[model samples]
Target: MTFMKLKFGTAVLLGSLLIGACPALAEAVLHRGNSGEPQTLDPSQTSLEIEAFILKDLYEGLTSYDAAGRIVPGAAESWTVSDDGTVYTFKIHDKANWSDGTPVLAEDFVFSMRRVEDPKTAAGYANILYPIKNAEKVNKGELPVDQLGIKAIDAKTLEITLERPTPFFVELLAHQTALPVNKASFEKNGADFIKPGKLVSNGAFELAEHVQNDHLTAVKNPDYWDAANVKLDKVIFYPSEDQAAAVRRFEAGELQLVYNFSADQIERLRASHGDEVRVTAALSTYFYSFDTRIEPFKDVRVRRALSMAIDRDFLSKEIYSGAQLPAYSLIPLGIATYGEPARPDFADWSQLDREDKAIELMKEAGYGEGGKPLNIEIRYNTNPNHERVAIAVADMWKKTFGANVTLLQNDISAHYAYLKEGGKFNAARAGWTADYADAENFLAINLKKNPVFNYGRYDNPEYDALVEKSYNEKDPAARSKIMHEAEAIVLRDQPIAPMMNFGQLWLVSKKVKGWQDNGSNDHLSKYLSVEE
Candidate 1:
């Protein structure tokens, strides 16, 4: 009950449960709580999970994730790789059709990929397509969009040429950014196309209706290739920043599932919901980025000092109630599927030793020894747990090195927008969830030439070259070593101070079935069913 006090932003529709105007049916429906309103429905433009939740249902790419989070074929029934691994040829499913009964074709994917590479689109994840030959050039407007290495061989066949051999290219197809859009519908409707009935989809569900900041209703798409396996008749997703209110709704049976509850609520919910209260380790890192172009942060020592000063162990265990792991590296620890663990030099340091070294570094950087005490301000999105962590970090900085600290909070939408725009902040809270099961997904954000998610503006030629080398390395062991070197460069530079690794915590109804706790947090409605 104490967790009920967590305040929500104005967007959270407290107890409002409007289910659109659809007639009540005896069909199965799974009601879920989306963490927040999506910034955009355009798959190319979406950079957040809230948008991904809806887009995953609205569109299927060449491949998709299964219930166990393995990459499986979706729209493209099968694909073949050349001996060199630079070329891929896919066979589109003939039965794949959009919601409006239009046939899904190879041309659709070609158009979508070009759209992402177009500078006019300003897609945040455009760089993800850089593996395709000339994609980076096209995105930078140095080459024509048509030059991008993707072609529609025929209505049912698609061929793509990569700049280099990328082992994860097939798995990358499962990402929302790789989804195809109906070129006709997109051009005709333009900006107004994201609305409910106006959107055309080829996935398991189609947009039935949507109310901004309230709820989005998706009904099973009859035209979907595998619609027969889509057991749920409808799924309604409510977007709310109010974790407590969402939990309350889940308890009252108004909602079937809620996501990302506060650490304080976990124990209580675990006791009450038992098996329905889910927790799974996430391949994500919650960190704060510095504007490295600025004066103090421009100095690597100042950056390193501030990063080493925080007691991440204390913050994770004490403040977050052991809901997270203390992180010293940008990538989460022990994700060995991709490569060897990227261990930072300070990864094994004790809290007291780290703090002492932090002070020494600060003094060397001309601060905290009767010099101007380092002034820092941290900006983060509104969340009870985030606020607590920021406050704890601020306290740590002040106590350890006598640094002045300021805390600023913004709503979820505004917060991401501000960071994306390269807004100035001493340190800004940021997080990265894996788009695919690879270390490259996490490392790509900080690539010096990348304009997308590089909020820190961390420019290092050595780091950039190392990452590029990894992409082209033919051997897995060789590629991983290159990636490790790239990660180490950034870790030493400290453009982003590693905070804590995440574990997704969800409250589900006992009546809901087929939910799996996977690292990707990619549970699709196609696999879920509700009890009568």
Candidate 2:
């Protein structure tokens, strides 16, 4: 891994002392509980906490989502769409440059997009670019990678021709998979650039230092296009896995911000600093998926019985302490096109009358209540909150369906390993955050042959057809109707049980100002001001 060491001398010592003495003059330290270690810093290959955290500091896309979740220009100053909507021409910003002062040209975008789609990269969202001409064929190795649609007209112009007119193309570019990278920097660092200090960035901040499992420090980028508006001089992120430890760090004045606090800690914090605690209902849903290819769970009735056995409202109120809202559908509220209105909720499945129905369904699936009880193991990460939720779910299943259930908890890394290998867990809990502001972002995961993000390995040709049609449909209302039908098919199958919608809680210190915790769930410390 690449590591940079500062010269050890009195100058460094004096700087440290000054930083410690004046909180406003020093970097703002933000503490958070990440469930797992970052697999890699390569924007194309990594997802989870690392991708979510690093994208804010180390990358810039042609377009970006603003605090209001609207598409805004980043490296690109302006763009034009053809009358037919198949051609997109972007005018690169004259001032954008890498941290090494190299000009960010249109070729960089082409290189980055092609690199993600390369078979060697294994990027999770590579299919996201399939709308671009030849992207799918190139990804499937049917066409050469060079044949991909993206091209550079010159140093300052990028022209993208698509096979179909994509209405959310600009919003999709804001995702990390589409972020530009410097070819020279990437080639020079080779595989080592994924580590700290070796990477080059043109975003609001640049990585200064990183200590494994301890902290990551980012300093403001002086060369950023919006440097004048960036308020923070530096940001320190502590990746503590313990929620209570994060709360203690915040209470001890070591951290200016904390998120994802435990239920008990949130209650205590609300009792004390209620005014400082901010809560926003997220467009995220936590759910459990069954590997239908596996035995027993292969039965649709058994899956529906398991779904009916769990009480979402009870879980939200008791385990989550009302911090979450019960989720009846995969798409959360506030998502524009695929919000709650676009999907059919399970009205017949209810906490009140669902338990007896669950027993009957399980019996019909060849496991009679009080007879040969169906034994199953449910798995989740080893976080305290996750364990508590899993245990509660296990108890609910046992009581309602009269089936024996076991709770299995592993560290985040081990759990992900089990998922990748398609281990024998009957069910597993997972969550997905949006990549862009579209219903397609949520619905695309169910595409029949998609290798990434479809961990359930769900294959439904009808759903896939509807998704493809919706992608090219320019009329919002017409597309939404098709998407609604697709959502109905998925819900009816019950391959996954939608649990709850997240209500993210962030504690910000009084010294921090001008920060808006937007719906995208990104924390851009550069937009925060330390009180003078």
Candidate 3:
């Protein structure tokens, strides 16, 4: 109902243009600024937040987030959980229809569930569906794709069996990874199903054009289930990785919304645009993952020393201008269900004392000047903010540990590809935005089971066992406790050094309406309108 209430009073927009003796209405358009060029528009193939922002516009999942980031019914009109909480049944909305005028069926979701879990699909976040019975085994190639616990009970009814009692299953369903891909379109076009003419979306909008680095455009879908309530006629998403350029464009009135601008420009942007500038705490974490599969980093003392020596507080206050908060644990604070995640023992220590201890630890671990020279490379994506953060961290290591550090920069797409494809590296920058509200979503990244997300290749049998135990625990309180223990273990080992919890920054034009700040940071185009 929250989503229902967010809709504009009238779905239709009217703009008068005197055409000789008659008046014509202009098409309602929204110019949106996204972070970077998407690697792919395929929901299953994308791992970036920027891609998700657009995908949510083109695809509808069983559940979706509203303008306020609250979960709401989406493609599935209604769903019910079994008494045991291991099975879910969803009734597809009768009005749900793909862009091509085909009725959205339960079988569509069933096919998507199987494909995403199959080894052939190569979905980056395939592990997100691990809750489904035999889902993990199917993804791991131990089970057939047909073994994934999803079935079309009827044309409009879908049934899913879970491996265990998953409390966040509904929340996870709203993630972009869970969105259904039309089987007919995929089979017909092969990998090109995402092309403008081929992509058959079941959301409020459908892809109209994609101009790579320029912009991707989507026009309203007449066949959308709630088309009558959908206001925007078209939405243009610009890949604005260059924040300065994006800011200039926004100031020039070329864009109504810009995402991820330079944090240092906050004051000036706010001064110039007044209340148009926006900042909201994100349920996300930015960190550097160590290649634990390699030497030096394999040693806990060396890893801990490197992590402890870095002054996170300084980076948050100086580099990001308070746009982020110093993080000690990989999981961000204030996640629902799980409260106050465990932190490193050195978390409360003064920076001066921590640095001294770090030096001693490095020397003891056969690193630093007296021992082996710690030659390390810091890999990060090509963004001004990332470059500055990498340089600051590299400088800290050079000064404190007397280690030689090298920095490697790649574009957003290539940077993630290198890590996800299991490319060998020293230390690489990584950030995770929550796919759902669960702490397990964050902890699952470090699991040995998730190689794509677990770029560090951190394998701890005890930690993995604890996580598995939590999955089958059934009781919420007990599961939380077990997860806390597992997190404590990971923090102690420190395979990934927590840098900061993110605060998403954006610039919204005054012409834009229905923009609301949310912790999850999802502001769907369907809930927004623009006034000319």
Candidate 4:
């Protein structure tokens, strides 16, 4: 008990050491190995999934994800939707309080929603909130933040109106962008409120400290509305960019949960740790985006040829160790009710036929032994897995088109920031895990309206219209059909070349309880308990 209350810097160090030396001290302390350091703790300002993992514990949204990644009640005890299915009213429990013991009012949600869509705030994932009325306009600087459709009905009740009917609207609230900020703390400290000492969160845990490149610590929040049910006293997340070393740490008992270990280690891990090596199919796609705004790639033939030339089977079986399946379309299987996504004509072609056609396509695009030199610069984020994949793709490009290829690597944060901030490049690696199970979540990245996640800057009007039509369509079958059509257009245009459908390869310690494998791959620390 005494060791659990150690100060920030000292706690991360001595706690790990003391816990290892005294097994009794390790009870209720969880050391989670995260993919990388969070880019920012601010809900409105982050785009990375790693940051969402920590934010979910510190900030409860109107609706929240359960242990199974399904939508469930959170700060709002319950909510009702209008018969038209556009307006929603949420009732926050009077007992809901921030970490500082102040009541969480409905005005806080209104303020937070407005803040996230305010163009001045620059939320990278803002488009996800566009289902709310005027949210897109507000985020695009066309409308005033106050004009956003959220309203505080009373001190404890909140109402939100959507511009159009959205079936997935309730589930959308479970995203990190919908996490409310403590109005008092935010007003008092401004942007610094996300800092350790100033952040007044309302979830099961509160931020204790974040030592960059080391660990982020959160302790149980006594003031939380559901504090009585929270089992873990402290949650410490360690950024494990070097996953191999992280596996070593996991083997040494320094970390109870290690995520995204190198796939090449799957067999050895299974033999050694048994069920601790959690492997499952995930609704995620790893793809490379050709900068549609730039040349060589500006030609559709060049983009399609390069995409077809890559031997996805080799990448899946050889590089990923058969953990992932080769993907030919942006939408992966088992997403919502969208059914199977439509694939391009080349999807069923053999590798040999695809390569021969790729060569012919390259020649037609004026590359190969005659016209323009195909000097491709591929940019991928830092990770042993991503680097290996990039090198393999480079070799395939060289073999197929005799293209001069260069690979650019940057740290995770910097790499994504460069693409998101509109830095120019020829081809860049991009991966998407569905924010919701909907196909729109995957296909919407190519939408011109989504400048943040639309890294390649692709702006196809027909594709955009079909996606928008699906959102407003009432019939589920018709909506899914519209979305499927939208996916087809992107595949034909080849804005992004889908390489693989990810199989979530993770290591969850058997000692941790309440974890369920789900498509979205979100496991909240609040729902999990650490066992001795």
lDDT of each: 0.86, 0.76, 0.91, 0.90
lDDT of 1: 0.86
TM-score of each prediction: 0.93, 0.91, 0.95, 0.94
Task: Give the alpha carbon lDDT tens digit for every residue of 1-532 in model 3.
Answer: 7666555423322212243334224578999999889999887888899989999999999999999999999999899999998999999999999999999999999999898988988898898899999998999899999989999999999999998888889988999899999999999999999998999999999999999899899999999999998889999999998888998999999999999888888888888889999889998999999999898999999999999999999999988889999999988887879999999999999999999999989989998988988999999998888889999999999999888999999889899998999998889999998888888988999999789999989999999999888888877888899999999999999999999999989899999998999998888999998887
- Put down candidate 1 lDDT per residue, 202-313, tens digits, no spaces: 9999999988888999999999999998889999999868888988899889999888788877778778878888878899999989899897888898888888888888
Q: For all candidates, what are the clash counts?
A: 0, 0, 0, 0
Itemize residue pairs with steric clashes in candidate 3: none
Q: Would you give me the overall lDDT of model 2?
A: 0.76
> How high a TM-score does candidate 3 get?
0.95
- Candidate 2 differs from the real structure by a C-alpha RMSD in angstroms, to one decimal, of 6.1
Winner by TM-score between candidate 4 and candidate 3: 3
Model 2 CA deviation exceeding 4 Å by range = 1-36, 342-349, 368-372, 420-424
Candidate 4 residue runs with Cα over 4 Å from true position: 1-27
TM-score of 2: 0.91
Better of 2 and 3 by TM-score: 3
Clashing pairs in 1: none
The superposed Cα distance between candidate 1 and the true structure at residue 75, in angstroms, equals: 0.6
User: What's every prediction's RMSD, in angstroms?
Assistant: 9.6, 6.1, 5.9, 5.7
